[model samples]
Target chain A: AQSVTQPDIHITVSEGASLELRCNYSYGATPYLFWYVQSPGQGLQLLLKYFSGDTLVQGIKGFEAEFKRSQSSFNLRKPSVHWSDAAEYFCAVGAYTDKLIFGTGTRLQVFP
Target chain B: EPEVTQTPSHQVTQMGQEVILRCVPISNHLYFYWYRQILGQKVEFLVSFYNNEISEKSEIFDDQFSVERPDGSNFTLKIRSTKLEDSAMYFCASSGGTGLSDTQYFGPGTRLTVL
Candidate 1:
């Protein structure tokens, strides 16, 4: 079955520091990978997605993700983290159907 | 920018009672979906609807659950008999199409607490 894995349960980074959140996925066919972020009591917000073509994808809020087919990874990165960037991040792999298989999520804490 | 909207940010209900979660998808979107995330767990797909009918559903969406698009604007998910295990954050999403360029836009979600 298609699934997603976010190895880091929690990550802490100081303001203005670089950030990287790891994600791995398992799928049978060509995968449609996506990164979403959720704030406290808020809905999931799309960060970026990789369907095909270029491996590096840019998204809203200064977020970017790189899809590595060999490693089966789509890691999210931000050069400078802000205090407001603290939130839970999820990785998801879209199935052939409409449903999306999501990761367990990684809680990010931004320190000042 | 247009967005999917859901009603009642939070709901508290007793077990075995019926609860209906409502959503108004983006006006021009053609596909609608429901997903839930249990506390500390991955978000799971419950069901998907298109053309006024269910396109697909997961095993978690058993006989206890049903979905309907009553009018041009409202899409709803109804649980006939709510269970304590049903407590979670339910999200409503919609997409213009299933094509490569189409992306699903999610609503803020409704937090259901069944006791």
Candidate 2:
């Protein structure tokens, strides 16, 4: 079965520090990857997605993800983290049928 | 921007009782989906609906669960006999198109607590 794996359970970063959340997937074919963020007491928000393109896709809230087929990974990266960036991040792989298999998620804590 | 909206932000019910969660998808969306997240767990897909019919459903969505597009805009999920394990946050999502590339917009979920 297809699955998504987010290796980081929790990550702490100082404000203005660089951030990287690792994600790997197991799928049969070229997968449609996505990154979503959820703040406390809020709904899941789409940060970015990778279907077929230049391997790098930019998204809202100054977020971006790169789809690396060789590594079977789609890690999310941000040059600088803000206090507002503290949230839970989920990586997902979309099936051809449009069903999304999501990872357990990585909780980010940004400190001042 | 148009967004999906779900009613009854939180619900508390006794075990074995029935509960219906309602959602109003974006006006132009053609595909709708239901997902659930147990406390501290990943979001799991339950079912997908289109054209007044179910396209795909996960094993987690058994006879106990049913979805309907009862009206042009309202989409609902009904749990026939809720169990204690049914406590979770249920989310409704919609996509403007049917393809995997289409973006799905999710609604603020309804927290169901079965006592």
What TM-score goes with each of the models? 0.97, 0.97
Give the DockQ-based CAPRI class for model 1.
medium
Report, for every candidate in turn, its global Cα lDDT versus the true structure: 0.92, 0.94
Candidate 1 per-residue lDDT, tens place, A1-112, comes to: 7789999999999999999999999998888888999998899999888888999999989999999989999999999999999999999988434678899999999999
List model 2 lDDT by residue over A15-73, tens digit each. 99999999999998778899999999789999999989789999988899999999999
lDDT of 2 at B67: 100
- How many residue pairs clash in model 1? 0
Per-residue lDDT of B1-115 in model 2, one digit per residue for the tens?
A: 8999998999999999999999999998999999999999999999999888999999999999999998899999999999999999999999888665788889999999999
Q: Residue B98 lDDT in model 2?
A: 60
Which stretches of candidate 2 lie above 4 Å from their native place? B98-100
Worst 10 residues of 2 chain A by lDDT: A92-101
Best by the DockQ measure: 2
Candidate 2 lDDT at A103 equals 98
Fraction of reference contacts reproduced per prediction? 0.65, 0.70
